[model samples]
Target: MAKLEIVSPVTGSPRDVWASLRCAAEDAARDEPQLASQLNSVILSHDDLSGALSFQIARKLGDSELGAMTVREVALAAMQADPSIVRSAEADLLAVEERDPAIRSMLQPFLYFKGYQALQSWRVAHWLWEQGRDTLAFHFQSRISELFQVDIHPAAKIGSGVFVDHGTGIVIGETAVVGDEVSMLHAVTLGGTGAERGDRHPKIGRGVLLGAGAKVLGNIQIGDYAKVASGSVVLKPVPSGCTVAGVPARLVNCPTEAAPARTMDHTLADVVYDYVI
Candidate 1:
């Protein structure tokens, strides 16, 4: 099989990312002797990004219907077949590392973050969906939901550099489109308002920050650099660079930050708090 090559959108190549992960794993193993075997198998034993990712994700998602080795082979093949998958995966790793304060190194997300793992698995499932393998795609989705408690439809279009923090209870509808650099917290839903068939879900633009428990429903557009406050129910189009809040969300004010998603800021101004509709 041909090797998978990834070029990071932020900085470095696939080899660089893999080397960093390996070094981190080695340091972690030395620091914590009990977990040496697990770390070695998951990171140090693999030769490349694809191999390590394949093993880690497969181990988490695999079950009786499909063994770990079988799932690993599938993930590896997908990564090899589509170079973009590797690129996206790399971008995701960087995104998580840069944005999450708790993340100490690239290896942390690569080895133990369920959000990152679930997203990568979703990428493979999305690939299968594009290849007319809907049944297999759905199976992967099922496994992802079972393992991560995050339910993203196989048909949802998610862009790179996206971060799903505290990923449990996050749902993306089949027609939802999440753009690059979007950050969403747990219990968020990009859903449809009703049983509308085609193009029913929301279109989330780049650099958008969705606070925890936010529900964006119907066929609407969330403009780039927009921020949706936690527990807000957004039913209409949110303008670019603005912040929205409340049950049927209203524009609170324009955010000061250029890209609120990158900053991961959840603070709303006191004036805006009083402006809730």
Candidate 2:
């Protein structure tokens, strides 16, 4: 990857993101001669972000039922119909580069990160779901899970600029709604506790941060800018701007960070806890 000067995910358009990505890919190819072909194939060859995304996803998800070309057509149709998917992809790519210190280039995430790839593929699956193509949508979902280990249902509505770190073992149930700029780590489950139907699963607000191994269950609301600490099992509603931790997660601190998702801070506040002998 090229020397990653600070790239803004919020300020630029998708076209800008594509340009930077191609620049970075060119630099990476030059830096590492062995990767030139892969870089050229994935980044330099494409005209825009959406075309690259469709090709990459199809290459990964294609199977006996749907070949790479057919899947590419499906993804391309969805992206062309609703351009928001590619826009969201751009946001997601920049979000990873912005939030994850490990990421130095947008090109790396756009080409290789399973989290970004999974989310973008899910966007196509989501479009399919919205069009009442449940079977094909589920096919995309299953392929995504099998390939990336991130299982987000097609019906789950996710917003833009979301950062999903590591992207392993993250399970988002049906009817779940994740707001814009939210960040979640590996092994996170936004699910329900009971079999009771209709609108089960959590509703995460904008700019919320869900730590690794966090389990937020039921149809409860996790308010905007709230932080769910790692390994915490949250069963009730979390107030906005608060931080919750532990089993049946309680408020560890109120008015934590204004935007914990962007900050990516997971440290608990200094507090004394009573323990009965």
Candidate 3:
């Protein structure tokens, strides 16, 4: 596999990302002729990233209450109302291509990755929730859960450049705040310890990585650049740049890498018993 050229959000504009996506789509069409028409309609036909994303999201989230065309219009309106949506979408695409070893092209996530699709759909739902359209926002949430198997409450504030890989069984509570550039794997939960009222969920900091099946409960903070190892049940705050693992997660060691999230390095160093309680 060729090394992917990392494109920073600061360096790569939305147009550049869109162009790359279009080029990838063209290549995919050439390689797999049968999907040419689908690719063209879903990606090449659109004028911008928002249009393509809106179309794909709407098609996936559409239901009897709202048809695909209607949902598409709503999604488009949301994207137009806030240009940040498109920008965030681009950042997310870049993050996936950069971090995910399995991904070969920018077009792959746009067309097929359920994690990407679920997150974008949540964005629209969040917009609706912000506008006081609670019913409609909940509707989108239901469809996303049913279709994608990833349940993120409409009010959860998720930052840009987040990659929720193999998103199945992932649950984020309403008050959960996932910071920018965070990478979460399958079956991870940002949830409450119990039936609490307000601000019950965990607050994940920037560039954090929550490994597969990790359950972070309550209002504790997982500090920036932290790593929660796979299947760990975290109940307390984890300091920045530390690695935690176990049923009730404990600090195993301080990660040497500045941002383990970006590196996606799951391996831990020799356990520093001094740090463990």
Candidate 4:
């Protein structure tokens, strides 16, 4: 894997990025003292700039604990865990550029795209969880949820090629399982039934499209190629090749053939391509 050349496009300086990142780190530490101490354990060799830009970003955005962690620490950690996180973010930026005519001149992904921050954060939490550091992992996850209005439990299993749109108010429970090529809109909840423990959340198969405000509760299975309509409350397992909608979500349309996996090629450039002139 190639080394990541992450520099602030605004300053065109790697050093400035590092300085800003440190400042952000300090601010995050101040907010979540315990997390700050733990992070310091890992980044002891580095200097604390006190006014780390990432921390300021979190503060400015009114992020909860989880959001601050995403910008301050988790993102960089993710870059270390899987270079693919960086690659995917870069690709998404390019895609947004290609598709959205308005974003041709924008330069600050760090400030604007929570999706990038969320994915980067997830990489670190996922790695931590794998290493049996659930406490720290859960702390980071909670921080992300507090800041971004996006809640993805550290234990939730999510495959690659996953796209989360309008990320605010999105929640994925601890036991939830999502497969590859899944696309979800805003206000979606892949949650559990009641307050039960252990594998109580929904299991989403591959190539599923969950519309905005869709809720799949309990230990139900959403088959591959399934579509849950907007504002639906699904309480049962859906068969493959079907589209379900409404409260107690029922099959609305059963196509002869299930849809293929949703395309995951949309780059960030494409999404932000349409910049407001």
Candidate 5:
């Protein structure tokens, strides 16, 4: 997703990240004695990212409906059946680390960032949805919405290396297809134009950046590396490597950066708009 996928200090496979995460957790424990128990329970106790994430997700989403142990089992089952879930989680961690300025280590996203947490939990829910377990999947969706303030339908197909920054108020529709290396800020909505069914949401291409408060409605194709400016309402298809801005988004810049999501830049170029305010 980044310029370097297997480089040192960032963007490696799950095993490499897991090793670093454990080391970071140990370092944090030594630095802050107060959080030693919390760090050990969440990170040191687990053997891998899948195990750690399952435990963490259960702790966050568990309730009276299903105890934390049961939630952890469900998550573990999903990840065990499909190893890609853990791989996606690793890629997501890298995405957050590389894209967000506030991120200090992979441990931060794994333990604290609600965007990463919510997205990973949704992956489990998505697996459940695919298994024809709608009731349980809806339960996850509801809980995720309530806890994280991010509502993503279980049927959404999100790719790895996807970063959802400040995930509050983010709503992804059922048929939305987010590609790899995509990044979106808070209040971004991938929704339909009207009440419809069957492939109605946006098909976001790889390496796209959807700025804060951007609403991309209808069955639109956001081509790879396209950027939707903040507060823009995009109703039409955006061409590859283009930047759109305004109420009904218009092309303000084309042939933009090849990987806007990786760069995490949404600054619009100075251009004169023909339409009046």
Candidate 6:
């Protein structure tokens, strides 16, 4: 794991400069009283956003051997910043952790984690949603997905350990249930078939992997350890320990055929930006 350097607010300090203006960036709300008041109107919305950001930091710290900086400290750092500032911090931390090779070598999760980036996006969207600004939240989320190729619904329920590789065009339904150790790639869809009102969409099991362009619609149960191939549209219950492919995906192989998880290529040098809490 990479060493957690304690940055200082001032330069030329013995310890690393852990406290910088980057972490203390101000928000647009500072100049806009109406926006600030609007955000505060939501009960405890700021605190909720903080907690969500904290959760992502903790997940990123999973089992890493940092010298002293703990996940809690990351959350604390996030909390100290204004909500808008925290949003950028969360994105910076995620962008570095998820795609930066320099930091990847220093972090254990560089090779095997997913939820760090996903959760950060979710928290930002959730904060915006709470503030009654769904359009802005979704806009930010869409941009993240477009740039990172990792598509996660702003309203989806996601657990930790989600690895979304080549995430371009990945679509998660609003009513989807994602569990731990789940991995999906470009163009995968956990969506609904028709205009069903109540409880439409797939119910994904824990530790499942959906290949690129795989579409699982309706209220179907994709059992644990299930894998769906690219371009497959599943409308039936996929039993545990099975790999399904093609339209209306059916069981083709058993769980023993489950392949090892892989990481996505993050070599593109585009600027990655996300909304702050």
Instruction: Supply the TM-score for candidate 2.
Output: 0.93
Candidate 6 local lDDT, 1-277, one digit each (tens): 1212332212323331122211221232355466554323321232333443454444443343431235445444535543543444333333333333434221223223343454454555555555566785576466556545556566666654455554556677777887655667667788888877777878888767777778888888888767777788788888785667666565556543443222332121133221110
Write one digit per residue (lDDT tens) for candidate 4, span 1-277.
Answer: 3433433322444433333334554566687787776446433234432222234334433354346555556445545566655444443333233223434221223335565456545655776787788997887687678667888988888765555665788999888998865777779999977877887999999878788899999989989877777898998898875677667676666641344335322211212211111
Residue pairs whose backbone atoms clash in candidate 5: none
TM-scores of all candidate predictions against the true structure: 0.93, 0.93, 0.94, 0.63, 0.94, 0.52
Candidate 6 local accuracy as lDDT?
Answer: 0.52
Residue-level lDDT tens digits of model 5 in 89-147: 87888788788899778888888889999999999999999999999999999999999
- Per-residue lDDT tens digits for candidate 1, residues 175-272, read 99999999999999999988779999999999999999999998899999999999999998988888998988987886546889999999986666
Q: Once superposed on the true structure, which residue ranges of model 4 sit more than 4 Å away at CA?
A: 3-111, 256-277
Model 4 error, position 277 (Å): 47
- C-alpha lDDT values of all predictions: 0.87, 0.88, 0.88, 0.61, 0.88, 0.52
Candidate 1 or 5, higher lDDT? 5
TM-score of 3: 0.94
Once fitted onto the true fold, the runs of candidate 1 whose alpha carbons sit more than 4 angstroms away are 1-15, 273-277
lDDT of 2 by residue, 1-277 (tens): 1122323655553336788888998999999999999888777898888777888999899999899999999999998899888778877887887798887788778878898899999999999999999999999999999999999999999999999998999999999999999999999999989999999999999999999999999999999999999999999898898888888788878878687898798897787231211
Count of backbone collisions within predicted model 5: 0
lDDT, candidate 5, residue 82?
A: 90
Candidate 3 least-lDDT 10 residues: 1-10
Q: Number of clashing pairs, model 6?
A: 13
The C-alpha stretches of model 6 lying farther than 4 A from their native spots are: 1-119, 127-136, 149-151, 257-277
CA lDDT for candidate 2: 0.88
